[model samples]
Target chain A: MNKHPHIRIDRYALVRNTVFVWLTAVVVAGFLVNIPRINILEHTARNLYFHVPMWFTMMAAVGVSGYHSLRLLQTGSLIRDIRAMQAARVGAWFGVLGLLTGIIWSKFTWYVGTDVWWNFDPRQTMASLQLLIYGAYFVLRSALDDPDRRARIAAVYNLFAATTTPFLLYVIPRQLQSLHPGAEGNPAFSDITEPVMRLIFYPAIIGFIGLFWVLYTQRVRTAWIKYRVIRDPEL
Target chain B: MEQEVQSIQDSLRAKESISTPFDSIWTGADVPTVDPSALEQVMLSNDKLYVVLAVVLLIWFGFIFFVYRTDRRLSQVERTLEDRIYERDDEV
Candidate 1:
C-alpha cells in the first residue's frame, strides 16, 4: 500500500467534500443569478452555464485520460492504465449529459414550433460521433483477454480517440453551419451575451470540471483496489 | 382566433418598426406555426419551466445511476474481503 501511492486514500475525502459544496453553490447561483434574456433563448439561456460546462469538463477529462494513457505507454504502469480508463469512462458520461442537455435546450429554443427534438445540427452530430470514437476505445478494451496487451492496445486507441475529440466537438462543428453560438460568423459570446453571465458561467465550468475529477478519482480508487486484489486491472 | 389576429397585428406593427426578418417571418406566417400537443403545451408554458424540470430530472437520474454503480462496486469489494476473511478463519 505504501509503495502504491495512487491507491492510498489521502486527502481525497477533503477534496470530494469541497467539490460537493462548490457544485451546490454553482447550481444555486446558476438559477438565482439574473441573466439578461434574449427573445428566443429566454430562460433557456441559463443553460449556457450548465450545458457548455459539460463539454469543458469532458475536454478536461479527455486531457486527464490522454495524459495517463501516454504515461501508461511510456512506463507501462498499471495505475496509469486504470486512471486512463476511468477518466475516459467518466468523460463519456459527461458527454452524454451534454448531448441530452443540448437536445432539450434546442428543442424549446430553436425547434419550439417544429416539435423536433433532434435536428442533426452540426455540433450535435459531431458530439455524438466523438462519443462513438470513445465507445470504440471501451469495446477495444473488452475484446482483449490479456491485461498487458489490453492496456497497451487500449492506451493507443484512447490516444487516438482523445486526439479526434477536439476536432469533432469544436473545429469541425464550427466549420459548418450550426445553431450553436460561435458558429459561422455568429460570435460565440459576443456583447449580445451579457457580461454578467460570466460571473456564474466561469465558476460553473470549474465546478463541473471539479465534479468530473471527484467522480473519476472515485472510480480510479476502486479500480486500483480491485487491481491489488485480483492482479488484473482491466476495469 | 383572437390571439392569432393579435399576433398578426403585432407582427405587422413590429415589421414597420423593426425589420428583424426572423421574428417577423415567424409571427407573420398566415398559418399558425405550431399545434403543440397537450404534453408539449404543458411543458412549453411558463417560459418552458418544465424544460428546466426535465433537464434537472435527467441529471438527477444520471446521478442516481452513478450511485447505484458505486454501491454495486462496494458490495463486490466487500464480498472479496469477506471471502478472504473466511479463508483465513479456516486456515487458523
Candidate 2:
C-alpha cells in the first residue's frame, strides 16, 4: 500500500483536473478564433493547434524520459526505470498521433488533387525515422529478461534514442527541402504564423504537454503498484 | 478533363504570382496534378476543414486506444491479485 511514496495523489489530481479544463478551453478557442485564410491552408490552419502541439508534447515527453534514464544510470533506482519507460511509451503514442495527423493534413493541402499521400517530405520522413528509433528502444527492453540488466541496457539505449530525437525532428529536417515551415530557406514559423493563431497555439502546446504528464504519471503509478505486488517493475 | 486542367493551371498561375519559396516548389510545373478522387473530393471540401476534423478524430481515437491498453494492464494486475489471494487461502 505504501509502495508509491513519490506520487502525491492530491497534487496529481489537481493537475489532471486543471489540464482537463485547460485543454477544453484550448480546443474551443482553437476552433472559434478567426484567422485570415491563406490559399491552400484555409481552415486547416486550425491544425496548428492540434498537430503541431503533438510534436512539442512528444519532445517534452522525450526530455522527461531522458532525464529519468539519466537518473536511473546514476542511482540504479527501479523507480527511475519505470518512469523512463512509461514516459517513452506515452511519448511514442504522441509521436504516432503527430505523424498520422501530419499525413492527413498534408494529404489534403500539399497533395491536393494528386493521389500522393506520402511524397517523402523531409520532415515527415525524419519524424517517422525518429519514431523507429524509439521503437527500437522498446523492442530492446522486451528482449532483456533480467530487470536490473534490462533497466541499465534500456536506459543506455533510451539515451541514444533521445540524442537522435532533436536531430531527426528539427535539425536534419530543417537542413533539407520540405513543405514544412522552417525548412531550408523557407519562412520560419515566426514569419508565417499570425499573431491571432499564437493566442491559441501556445496554450494548446502547454495543454497537450500537460496531458502527456498526466498519462505518464498514471502509467508510472500503475507500474509502481505492479512492482510492489508482483516484484516485477517492467511495464 | 480539359476544364479541370485549365482550372488547375489557372490556380497555379495565380499561385505563381504570389508564390512563397515553399509554394513555388510544390506548385512548380514538375509537380503533377490529377483529378480528385471521390474520397479526396469529400476531404478537400469546405476549405479542407475536414482535414482538421480528421486529424482531431485520429488523436481522439489514439487516446481511446491508449486507455484500453492501460485498462488491459490493470485487468492483468487484478487477475494476478485474485489468483494470489486464492493461493494464500488454499495454503491456510
Candidate 3:
C-alpha cells in the first residue's frame, strides 16, 4: 500500500548525506589513481575497491534480518517478521547491485575470453550462493498461505541460511583457493590499504551504509504507514 | 567472520598446529616485501585514490539527497490533503 505518510526528513540524515558525497569524491579522485604513471587500477578502475564494502553492508543487513527473524519466533510477533522481510528485501537490492557491478568490472578487467559470463572464483561462488539463499527466502514467503506459519518457518530458515553466510562467503572460501587475493587473512580489508585506498574505501563503506540506513528507515516507515492505512480506513 | 575463523582454527588445532600466522602468510605466494626506500612513494599513490574517491562520494550523495527530499515533500503534500479532507468533513 506504501502509506508512509509521516516521515520528517531527518535532518541528521540530511547532514549525514554530506558524508557520502564527500566519500564518493575522495574515492573517485584519490583512489582511482596510479603512480610511477602506471595504472595499477588498470581496467578495474576503482570499482573493486568500493564495491566490496557495499556488498558487505548488504550482507550485514540480511544477517540482522535473520537474527530478528529468530527473535520474532521467540516473541511470536509479526512486527519482527515484517522487519526481517523488509531487511531481506533491501539486502536483495544491494546484493543485486554488487553482483552486477562485480560482473561488469570483471568483464573489463579479469575476463579474457568469450566466456566472460561467470568465473569459478570463491568470491563469485559464495556471492552466487548468498543470492540464492535470499531467493529462497522469497520463495518461502510465497509458498505458504498461513501468515503465522509462513513467518515461523521462514524465520527458522532465515537463521539457518544466514548462519552459513560467514562460512560460505567468508571462511570456507578464504580457507579454500581464492581468486580475490588478500582474502585469506582479511577479506574485510587489507592492512596494507594505502592511505589513498582508505580515503575511498572508508567513505565508500560509510556512504553505502548510510544509503542502507535511509532505505531501512523508509521501509520501516512505509510498513508502519501501511498497517495504519489498512487497519483504519477512516484515517 | 571472526566466528568462522575460530571455527576453522578449532579444526586446525585438532589437526597439526601451525606455529603462527607468519607461517601461513608465507603460504603459496612469494611476492617480495617492499623495502623502506619505497615507503614514501607507496603512501603518495594511495593518497591519490582517496582524493578521487571523495569526489565520487559527493556526487553520489548529492543525487540521493535530491531524491529523498523530493519524496519527502511529496509525502508531506499527500498528508496535508488527507488532513484537509477530514477538516472539511467536520465543518460540514
Candidate 4:
C-alpha cells in the first residue's frame, strides 16, 4: 500500500479554533457597541448577519465544484472528482438555506398571502431550479457502477450545471423583475450600513466558510473510506 | 527512413489536437444584459427576517444530519479492517 507522502489532517481544527473566538468576540462586541439598528433590522433583529453569509459560502462551494469538474475532465484525477462531489453536496445545503431565508424574509415584508411554497419571482424561481438541476449531477455519478466512467460523466454534467449558477444568481435576477432588491442596488442593507454590520458579517462569512470546509472534508473522507471498503474487502 | 517516420509521427500528433466548438459558455441567445435595479424590492420586515432565519437554520440542520450520517458509516469500514487483521493474526 503506497500512502500519500505528506498527510494533512484537513486542518478543520484550526478553523474551529479560530472561528470560535472570532464569532464569540464579534457577538459580544456587537452587543456592547452602540450601533444604530435600522428599522428593517429591528424587525429581523440580528439574524441577517448569520444567514446571508451561509448562502454566499454555499455559492462559493458550488463554484469550486465547477472548477474541480473542469480539472477532473482535463486530468482525470479522482482527488478532483471527490472534491467536486463533496462541494456539490455542501452547495445543495446552502441552496436550501438561500431559498428558506428568501421565503421567510418575503413573509415578514409582505405580511399577507405567501402560503405558496414557491413564487415565480426571478430570484426565488431561478435559484431553486438551478439547485434542482445540479442536484441531478450527484444522482448521475452514483448511478454508475464503473468509477472512471462515472467521474467522467459527472464532470461533464457538473460543468453543464455550473454554467447555470452565474445565470441564476446574477444574470436572471437582473434580466427579469425580482423581489430581492439588494442584489442589484444598495447591496449593503438600506441606509448607511454600519461599520458594526461589517464587523459581524465578515466573521460570520469566515465562520460559515470554515464550517463548509469541515463538512467538505468529512464528506470526502467518508466517500474515500467507502471506496476502500469496496476495493479491499479483507482490509 | 528515420526522417520519413518522424514526419509520419508528427502528422499523427497534429491529428490528435483537441478542439471543439462551444468552448465559450457565453454564446448567442443566452446573454442577459439588463439593469438589476429594474427588479423589485429588497427590504424585508422584521417578521420576514424571522422566517428567513428559520429556513436557513433548517438548511444548516440538514447539513449536520447528512454529514454525520455519512461519517458514521466510516466506522463500519474500520471495524471490517480490524476483523480482517485479527483473522489473519489468528491464522499465523
All candidates: CA RMSD in angstroms? Answer: 9.1, 10.2, 15.9, 25.2
Quick one: RMSD of model 1?
9.1
The 10 consecutive residues of candidate 1 chain A with the worst lDDT sum are: A1-10
DockQ of 1: 0.06
Task: Name model 1 segments beyond 4 Å from true.
Answer: A1-4, A232-235, B1-92
**Candidates 1 and 3 compared by DockQ, better number:** 3
Per-residue C-alpha lDDT of model 4 across residues B1-92, encoded as one tens digit per residue: 44644544454345444344532222233322331121111212222343454465566557656655664575466566667767887997
Residue A27, model 1: Cα distance from true site in angstroms: 0.8
lDDT, candidate 4, at A228 = 60
Query: Model 3, range B12-88, lDDT digits (tens) per residue?
Result: 34434444564423444443344223433333344345444556667766777785775576568558656855786
Candidate 1 docking quality: incorrect, acceptable, medium or high: incorrect
Q: Poorest 10 consecutive residues of model 4 chain B by lDDT?
A: B35-44
Candidate 2 local lDDT, A1-235, one digit each (tens): 4323778766877887788778877876786677898999988898999999999999999999999999999999999999999999999999999999999999999999999999999999999999999999989999998889999999999999999999999989999989888999889889999998999999999999999988998888788776766673321
Ranking by DockQ: 3, 4, 2, 1
lDDT of 3 by residue, A1-235 (tens): 2233334556546754675566556555544455223243453545655678768778778777987898999998876887888888888889888888877766665675567657777787888888899899999899997768988999999888788777776677777666465566544446544565566666667677776766766676567556555555665
The superposed Cα distance between candidate 3 and the true structure at residue A101, in angstroms, equals 1.6
Using DockQ as the measure, which candidate wins?
Answer: 3
Superposed on the true chain A, the predicted chain A of model 2 yields a TM-score of 0.97
Q: What does the i-RMS of model 4 come to?
A: 5.6
Q: Model 2 residue B82 lDDT? A: 57
Q: Model 1: which residue pairs collide?
A: none
